[model samples]
Target chain A: MITLETIRTAHDRIRAHIHRTPILTNQTINELSGVHIFFKPENFQKIGAFKARGGLNAILQLSEQERYHGRTMGPVTTHSSGNHAQAVAFAARQVGIKAYIVMPRTAPQVKKDAVKGYGAEIIECEPTLEAREAGVREVIERTGAVLVHPFDDDRVIAGQATAAKELIEDADYDSFFDAILAPVGGGGLLSGTALSTHYLSPRTKVFAGEPEGAADAVLSFKSGKVEKAPYINSLADGLLTSLSERTLGYIREHVTDILTVSDAEISAAMRLVWERMKIVIEPSSAVPLAALFKNKAQFTGQKVGIILTGGNTDLGKLPF
Target chain B: MITLETIRTAHDRIRAHIHRTPILTNQTINELSGVHIFFKPENFQKIGAFKARGGLNAILQLSEQERYHGRTMGPVTTHSSGNHAQAVAFAARQVGIKAYIVMPRTAPQVKKDAVKGYGAEIIECEPTLEAREAGVREVIERTGAVLVHPFDDDRVIAGQATAAKELIEDADYDSFFDAILAPVGGGGLLSGTALSTHYLSPRTKVFAGEPEGAADAVLSFKSGKVEKAPYINSLADGLLTSLSERTLGYIREHVTDILTVSDAEISAAMRLVWERMKIVIEPSSAVPLAALFKNKAQFTGQKVGIILTGGNTDLGKLPF
Candidate 1:
């Protein structure tokens, strides 16, 4: 039910809380790919990801009844071991609210520390989606907190759309872009991008870049139904999640196509971005670039926009 | 004499050719150091350094008589194993001129390849400053090319000043910076930065950041004369060169002080920039930040500008 107006409202509401990340262009990359590319570096955003927009928008939109119970502000709860956990925690603290983040025990220490650093109370759970969800439910039941599902919520999707909205509006690309590409995870960024592009620049096609190892979005697009990968083995750890039905609905209606890229291609693209652009981008962010380069024939001689999802990576564990 | 007018002219001449590199800020670094830090990321510039501005300015400012010898365009020659070689080559190629770069045979293959990639012919020399100068002299004598000294030349220094000019003009700081710090090698960036700050933001004090292992700049500043390190041992390879007399003259006139940081501190600062700023900066660029952090007491509660000199690094040979 998220519309252009909803996304616009979210953008306006969260505008002050987030960074209007820079859109950078590289001549070498443009010449190599045979396409003019505008890269929206969300890694520079607050909390180091596009998720900040969604989390902030979602938190700021809470009604008085939802935010407060008596004199105390009610807690917000989420189950994520990824950027969303830190995003929600950061946004919650910004609004003077407590956050209960349910994370798996197997999650990286850096992510856990980041979430904790934001003044969020962590509820450790077993390394499974069901266990994580149950942990979140338990925290909510005990604390009377509202649950903000990462990608399933309409408000979150509307928040994510602001990244694309800003990209389309701010980039001084001559006229409109021929296409826009975003990596597909739980489909939050991809679906949000699809909606924004559909409303803002109807002529521009929205493409979803998914990892070949976790090709649920691609499979779902082909089968015309929600699908899950049997075994995910991509180096893009942020893209291992299956798409929610809500995200799939938006993708089916608005996204032009779902493209897949291998882990090797993702690593190569990541290295190129680091070496050429002098910007740090995670493997997930490189997926879109990998797909764009792999399908250069389809996008030759056209202006393209690529959303670099995030830049949270272990420098010690670089893929290269 | 290099004046503010000279720097301004360089800015105007090279404005169209080089990137107006972005000035970025980080809340984490500000909080950590107790100083408001404005980072002028010249690392993102063409040739991945501020040298591009100087190289482009020097080449473009060449007189028709100097640029051409009858029907044939005169070649430009320089001896550099660092970012300057690529900068001169890139600038030369942009103006339809040939570049002769002299480098030690022991220079990184990647550095040599980058110069060659820009259509510049590389003249391999022995790994000594004497050999480098002799090789450059040979190239100039053979081809009747003009020698563009990296930092000592007034035109190149003026070009380097443009980075600080843009930084002073573009940064959204509420007021002029209290102080500015730039890493010193042959003193091109530091002296240029001092001149720019002296002219533009007269209230701002300029400091030179140098590696402890290559503390010639500090020694020279104290002695009021040019000084050279007995043996350079810092990880910041770019700051190993001794300051030229032309550059030292400016440093003594305008620079507030010369501060030195250790290689360990440089590595730590570089890691922090990568992790927090989400930008790739070479070890040389980290010297300023390390110096700033070490002497936080001096700059406490003050607004400081740190020029990140370059981002050209061998990815496989990361210090971290």
Candidate 2:
């Protein structure tokens, strides 16, 4: 498990680079659910997602010798659906390194354009996890480039923890929140947030929100062991990752519960956010809110802090 | 003319009640136009439009006696397409007053539902200014309700100026900016921004961006007289207004340039913003960018500020 001290250090390092994203207070939501809901809107970050925090922090933490001597080679390589690819590409550009992104051919054009705009090279692959993984491995082997796994690295986890650190520091809602809910995919973000909350604000319980179709984390939490889904089939593409070993350990210790919601629920939550908050957020970011609404009985009369993890949704293709 | 001091006072009165919306740095636009472009994203404001600033400030300024007395006489009335109507409805509901909104029958159902969600009574009229004005007057007189003009009012103009105030306060780009560009409708917002730039940073020039199809503001500015269009037939519904007397006076003195963009250019700008920034914005908010892009020569190598006044666009029905 990642230590709280490491998470704290990561928070301090990334504080200047990442946006202390705002928490939106919804009166209408409170009135309807009888739950005090505060949305940690990470959608407003520099790269339009929280992935920037982890990607940038990890890249920045490389030793001076490692960086200058090309110990990590000339490029950064990653396999991502969208947001993570953009984050890696953006961070690589910032640090004067080339980025080679392996994306499924079916990925949205907008995401592709964004990655390209950040001066990254794109390698298109078949729309399959195996294909993406194989493609990324080939690139890493051929170019001798550093592989920035989207959410599985310890440094990445620590960097993602900074979001929770800022949220806790900016808002005096320590005693107000009964639990903190975050979307769980490969689990770097969830692990980092859980780690930060366990030490910084131990009173608040941590809950992992997973889509029903991609509920590997839920099964893992239930079985008291790590689990993996061979392939994910859900609208929340960002949450398709099977649990990593480090994230599994973090969840076993810090996460109190794992909740699941259907794709329909995720879509509905996305619409609610757009219509009510006027902020554009991707379907993956809406999973936590879906979990909150699905399990309202558990959260009623309690303050629930939900991390809206990303906003990479293409407005043109809204399910509505 | 409403002095900049009065606008600053309005800003203070409503600062806590409204959101300090973010300024979007347009990197893609800057590269495309050879201009440093910064967009004031007022679409993220409370009530999902810039109108909230004015509505909240106007309501906050009312005396305690007015709060109680106003409620007894029934709802406040306003004639608007959606944005201002929703703003007034939200403000009225927040202050415990009933609201009656007169909207065109052709108004989007989503907007009507938003107003209704705020507990406002909606009165529909033919999709014409004459019909809307007549219908709203009847409702106002019958209910003894106060009328909140969408624009063309001192309070609204003062409230609108806060966007410019915030832009200057948050970004110290005075050295880079040659001009601030804003869309003009009834001229309330443009006039307010002009006054703000004129007094706060006299070195920066102010430009009004108007729709080519609805070029009343541009004609008025060029003629050095208040001009009214026989009818508004532009896609930018928010900029379809005849300039008010006070607004005209301020624009005549403080505004340096008035430029127009075709509706096609506005549509392209909206698409670019959605595709690039991943933020949904309405047609009026895209006008300033359209003007800058259409007349690239005017803005090349110059720092420009464009107020993206609202983001109330329905992603489902994008013009593209």
Candidate topping TM-score: 1
- Model 2 clashing residue pairs (backbone): none
Worst 10 residues of 2 chain A by lDDT: A59-68
**Tens-place lDDT digits, model 2, residues A134-201:** 99999989997788887779989988888877777666756556888899998999998888888788
DockQ of each: 0.83, 0.43
lDDT of 1 by residue, B5-43 (tens): 899888888888888887789999999999999999988
Isolated chain A TM-score, each model: 0.96, 0.93
Candidate 1: fraction of native contacts reproduced? 0.76
If you superpose only chain B onto the true chain B, what TM-score does each candidate give?
A: 0.96, 0.93
How good is model 1 by TM-score?
0.97
TM-score to native of every candidate shown: 0.97, 0.90
lDDT of 2 by residue, B63-113 (tens): 344656873434678999868998889888877888889999999888999
